[model samples]
Target: MLNRALRLPTRAFVQVRSPRGAFDATLGNLSAAGARLVGIPERTIIVGDWIGIHCVGQNYSAEVRWHFDDTCGLMFEEPLSEYQIMTILGSRVAL
Candidate 1:
């Protein structure tokens, strides 16, 4: 059974940093536990790789969980609160 909370669809632009370097990606969906990203170059990252993600003035430590083509899934080191997720989304809208 899936145990994760429902993910909220979003189109926020985020910066991603991997061992290779930093790149820009689009946030597809987000939840307290993880996020799905698109526009990442294929083969640039692998499962279990540690990465840093920046979005809406917030920084997060995450681990790559899976990837397919240009999209990848990330699991956050520390889960975000519902309030925090809303705050980030709100900031993006306000900008």
Candidate 2:
């Protein structure tokens, strides 16, 4: 899938957490606006579902924009600073 603009598609293992409970999943493709993930819970988070992401020693909160089995899209509620995005991308690329 593609995201806003034209960021190179990158894959990463991300830890997704929910306020209602705990969710651990991997993000396969990511960009500045949204991402596609895998291993989403059976009680799948739907559009607008609030969530938190743990990556590269940083935490970010976002909302679920769309989802399918083992794949979900997220839009960061609070845009990450350039430093933060770089940190996440660097760690994932390094892996």
Q: Number of the top candidate by TM-score? A: 1
lDDT for 22 (candidate 1): 90
lDDT of 1 at 85: 86
What number of clashing residue pairs does each candidate have, in the order they appear?
Answer: 0, 0
| Highest lDDT against the true fold, candidate | 1
Assess the local accuracy of residue 56 in candidate 2 as a C-alpha lDDT between 0 and 100.
Answer: 80
lDDT of 2 by residue, 1-95 (tens): 84464443566667788756677777666666666777887775777788988888778888888878768878887766667667766776644
Q: Give TM per candidate.
A: 0.88, 0.77
Instruction: Estimate the overall C-alpha local distance difference test score of candidate 2.
Output: 0.73
User: Where does candidate 2 stray beyond 4 Å?
Assistant: 1-3, 93-95
Worst 10 residues of 1 by lDDT: 86-95
